[model samples]
Target: MPPLDSVLAGFADAFTLFNLLFVVAGVAMGQLVGAIPGIGPVMAMAIAIPFTFTLDTLPAVSFLVGIMKGGLFGGAIPAVLINTPGTPDAAATTFDGHPLAAKGKPLKATKMALYSSVTGDAFSDMVLILASAPIAVIALKLGPVEVCALMIFAFAVIAGLVGDSLIKGLIAALLGLLLATVQLDPEQATPRFDFGYFQLYDGVNLVAVAVGMLAVAEIVRRMAEHDGRPQPAAVPQSEEPGARGVSWREYWGCRWTMLRGALIGTGLGALPGLGSTAAAFMSYASAKRGDPGGVPFGEGNLRGIAATESANSAVMGANLIPLLGIGIPGSVSAALLISAFVIHGIQPGPLMFRTQPELVYGIFGAMLMANLCNLIVGQLSLRAWSAAVKAPASFIFPAALIFCIAGVYLSSGGLFGVSIMLIAAAVSLTLTAVGIPVIVLLITFFLGRRFETSLSQALTILDGDPRALTAHPVALILLVGALATGVWMARRR
Candidate 1:
């Protein structure tokens, strides 16, 4: 258990009026932005990230974290009605959610989605609170070799989780890795791809890369569709007429699905490599397989919504576990969270537990409060935007792109940012079309340095001593565990 006094102190401080307001504004804005086609919390935060440069750490974190929670819920809106996913994580929701809409019960689907998502998110946050410390302690004992191996393990996991094809995932990973080389070389500080342009010295802006790949490419794809007739179909009830309310009977019945999904999500989130996509898929699979009531998964079942939403929301809390516990990010959202910590001059490695307990616990408290705020605000305002997607994509997408471009400028202050955006978008489009997954590349891109540094350090240690592995008990243990786990997983597959 965490120190009670410290936890209480941090929780109290985080609950102040200002932080509360930040939470509210962030969730609301996050939802609004998420409603726009092709824009998600990751890209939304990428654009907003530059603006937060001037704000204090708490407000900035509060604002960003709110979007993350709200974004999950926001995706449900479009998925339920228009069949478009606001965020990548919501892709699964559309499977059963849109089908539910076609069946003339959009309101019921939305309600079930909100309820299940909140439950899943809340459950995962609880898990995060309970699991982070033990993981952190384990992370502390990890040495260079273990850390490097962990990154490799993460790459494999993401590759397996994303897309239908492993080959595609590997391609995307390679693409991302290639792009990661655009800036200066880590060891020499010498620019490798500058080509005499000062803008290339900083390499590529992550914001530009994320926004371009996620939003711009998506926008282009939408425009290429048949006459842009505006994706359609959901029940009028989904719009939430005053008469509609969640049926008590349905709520009670589907509650078990929520519980199971949340539990699954929490467990996956604690692991370093498995993320939301995995959680959502696993939750839905488990829920379907464990179904005792003989509910059909694809035919607008409340149970389906429960499983998907619960796992999706739970993903946010679970993602943070690895980030806070070990310096590894299980998902893109956690990857961005790392940037937030960097901006605050806080490192997230093993020592972070000792050096920055307050921030760590404060983040936990914030996550807890954010999920509560999401449920409250989501339920309260669910009726307001339940109808058709009101805004045109032309307007929403342009504004999103503009914000992204401006954010890139503010963050990097050069045309290289814009170039990176176009390049990443094109690359992302190509990879997706060809069925390559980007996640494998994201892991390698992010953890490449750690792998390199660790490998070099271990080599140096080995040059002077042959018994280095024996000397470092923690490293030896980690190696054995990694090998065992890998073989077992491979065999199972």
Candidate 2:
């Protein structure tokens, strides 16, 4: 770990006026996009990434983190107001949130969500601040052999858990791995699959791919799904006395439920590919099971809203654990962040701690600041964001598409990048239509080169001798874990 003084300085660095403005702006923008149907934080972040090219690293990352934290709560706005989830992770919130809205308590329901969201986000960020360095220290001791095995385990677990069909998930992961091999081979000086394009020699632009797959593709999908009719506006909140907000007593009542949900989210978020959607649903289910008599979950229960929002929001911070610790992205959002880190010439891994401890600690500080910004911005703008849920898909999708094109073009520095983005969008759309999870493909593509390089080095060390694996107990254990996960998935299938 860095010296205590260094950590303090890093935290202080995040308090600059420029950084604070970015955090507030990011949080506000995130909530607006998240409240508008079909434009969640992931898409917003992907579209906004290129605009951060000239920003200092700390402010840029802090802005993205702010968006992530704000979006978690903003998603609940539509879930409560319109019976539509703004993001997949907010789907669980609809179970109880909409019911509460129907009862003329839209304000109360949303307030519960915002409070729990901030609490869980702060809890997870604290966990990340405390745990990431130690995990990275331990990870630094592993050799290529162990890293290779660990990657295999990560892939196995990701494939098994991401989508309903394990076979389809595996296929998507393998396809990503193959596509990642398009650049020059690591060992050989020659390009492996450049297809005669010089741009391919340097590999596909990560920003283009991420923006295409997430932002542009989703815009197209939403536009196609629109029925060319104006949707109903959000439910009007109660104007009666004492009905416009959640009281401290009500918020304090669900404290244990929020804590349990936060714990579940943090645990699941640290693992690769499970995603916040799963965490929210799992936490909701657990809350339901544990509280059989209180408000009867799924029927306007404050506890249900607390459970889902807390768990999903907790995921924002906890998902960074693996990325900072071992250089593996735990979710698609984190994969996009990896591109951001790379763009700023900072590689995330154990060495990052040794070489750029200040940056890492600053990121931690920014995360905590984002939580505060999310809460403040969300509270002050609840009614405004709730109203934004009525935004038309036609206008939003086209505008977002423009941003996607512009962002990718600027980041990639050419029309070639735009072409790649269009192609990737087409591919992502097709995959989504077929029920294949695009997230699995994107994350595997992001990590493929590292996995392949580690595997190659491990093999060179072994020299074709299978028995040599015995010398690396960590690798053996990880490989065994991978095999076990595969078998378990097969059985479940």
- The lDDT per prediction is 0.72, 0.90
| Model 1 C-alpha lDDT per residue in residues 186-227, reported as the tens digit of each score | 778888877788776765666666657766776677666526
Compute the lDDT of residue 339 as modeled in candidate 1.
61
Candidate 2, overall lDDT?
A: 0.90
Q: What is the lDDT of residue 203 in candidate 2?
A: 77
Q: Please, what are the lDDT tens digits per residue for candidate 2 over residues 1-493?
A: 8888888888888887889999999899888988887999999999888988999899999898888778888889999988899999999999999998888889999999999999999999999988999999999999999999999999999988988888888999998898899898888869878888989887788899999999989888888889998878667667776567888888988999999999999999999988899999999999998995867888899999999999999887899999999988999889989888878988877777888888889899888888888888888998889778888777889899998988888999989999999999999999988988899999899888888899899999999797999999999999999999989998898
Residue 425, candidate 2: alpha-carbon lDDT? 96
Lowest lDDT sum, 10 consecutive residues, model 2, at 233-242
What's the TM-score of every candidate structure?
0.86, 0.98
Q: Between which residue pairs do clashes occur in model 2?
A: none
